[model samples]
Target: MSEKRALPWLDSPPDGFLEREQRIKSQKQVNIDVYGILRTKDVPQISFEVVGSTGNIYRTIIGNVPFCDCPDVRFRKVQCKHMCFVLSAMDVPSELRYQRSFLPSELREMLATLSLKRKLDTTTPTTAGEKKPVDGECPICFNDFKPKQKTTWCQDCGSNFHQGCFEKWRAAIQTSDNAVRCLYCKLPWKGDEPETPRPTPKAVEPEQRRSKMKYPNVGDN
Candidate 1:
C-alpha cells in the first residue's frame, strides 16, 4: 500500500500506480539479480541490482526516493518495479515511512536485539519442525555436505540439498508449464499441509551433525 506522505525527494505516484505495481508483481516481470544488494562503508544509499525481463542489471538506490535508474523511471519519471519490490518487502513503519534512507547503524541496533534473543532462546525447547538440524549429507548429490555452503530444504518431503545442487536440479527440471516443483515429491512447491504426515527419509547421523554453524557468502538470494 502506497502511503500519502511523500519522502523529501519523492512524490506520490500518479493514479493507477498501485494497480500497475501489483500487475508487474503478479506477472513476475522483474528479477532480483544475484549479488543485487550492495552496502558499503562509502555511501549511505544502499544499491540494489535488479534485472528486467531482458536480464540487464538496473541501477537502483534505496534512499529517500528509493529510485531505479531505468529509462522508464528516468524518462517517464514513474514508479518502477524495483522501487515497488523493496518498499513492499521492507515493511516500513507508518511513523517512519518518510525517512531518506535506513542507516547501517539502525540495522545493527536491530541485530543486537536479535543477539539477545539467541541467548534467551538457548534454554527454550523447540519443536521437531523448527530448527531441526538435518544430517551432513546432500540429498540431491547424496554426497557429504561441505562446510560453509548454503542449503535449502523441501518442507513437504523433508529433503535437503546444497544450494548449488538444488539450482542444478531446478534448472534441469522438465515439467508441464515449467512449474516450480519439489524435487523429491515432484509436486508443486506451493501446497496446503498434508493431513497425514508423509514418511520422511532418515537423515544419516542426524543428531551427530555439527552445531557450530557459520554462514557463508550468499551467492544469490
Candidate 2:
C-alpha cells in the first residue's frame, strides 16, 4: 500500500507562511470565546464554532477534508487564522496542523487529547467577601480543582466548587421555597436563585446517529 501522505499544504507554502500561522496561534486577540465543539461517534469528525477576533464566527472542521469556512481559506485556498487558532487551542502538533486530510484514527486521537479552557462568567455578581483564588478540593466532589477547570463560586461564602459538582449539589437541595445555599457555610447563595427546571429532551431513535459530545464554552474557574 502507498504510504499515507500528510501536510499537503507544506509542499508549496508561501514565503513566511509558517511564521504567520505561528503568530496567529499565539496572538491573544484571536479569541476563542462563544464556541461549541461537536464530536460524532459514528463519524470520525470534529467540528468547531470558533469566534474570530472581529466577533464573526467561523466553522472549522477536522475530517477527511479538513475545512474552514473563512475568506482566507475560501478565496486564497490556504489555512486561515481561525483554523490555526482551533488547531493550536486543541493542542494539535505543529507538524500536523497543516495536514490536508486526517485519518479516522487521527481524528479520534485528537478528540481524546483535547483540553478545553474554561472562561469565567463576568455576569455573576461579586459577593461581599474577597474573591478567593481557585484552590483546594471542591466541597461537593472533594476533587482538587484542575487548572482552568470550570467552577462556580458561592456568592455568600466566596467558596468555589466545580461547576458540574455545584450544579448537582445545588439541584439536590434547591427547592421552590428555599434558595440554593453554599455547601460549606450553609448560607443562602445571595445571587443564585432557584433554577427553573428545563423540559426533558425528546428521545432519539436507535437508528439515528448522535454526536458523542457537545462541549460548550464554559469559562475557567
Against the true structure, whose lDDT is highest?
A: 2
Please write out the lDDT profile of model 2 over residues 181-204, one tens digit for every residue. 664555667433345675343455
Candidate with top TM-score is: 2
> Mind giving the per-residue lDDT tens digits that candidate 1 earns over 1-221?
33232334324445656675575455332222222334455323445444343333455676534577776677887667665554433434423333444445543343343234323323444442343254544534434456777777655554556666555444323111255565445557532333344334356423222122211111232
Clashes of each: 1, 4
The lowest-lDDT stretch of 10 consecutive residues in candidate 1 is 209-218
lDDT of each: 0.45, 0.55
* RMSD, one per candidate, in order: 16.0, 12.8
Residue 59 CA error for candidate 1 (Å)?
2.1
Error of 1 at 3 (Å): 19
lDDT score for residue 18 of model 1: 65
Clashing pairs in 2: 118-219, 118-220, 119-219, 119-220
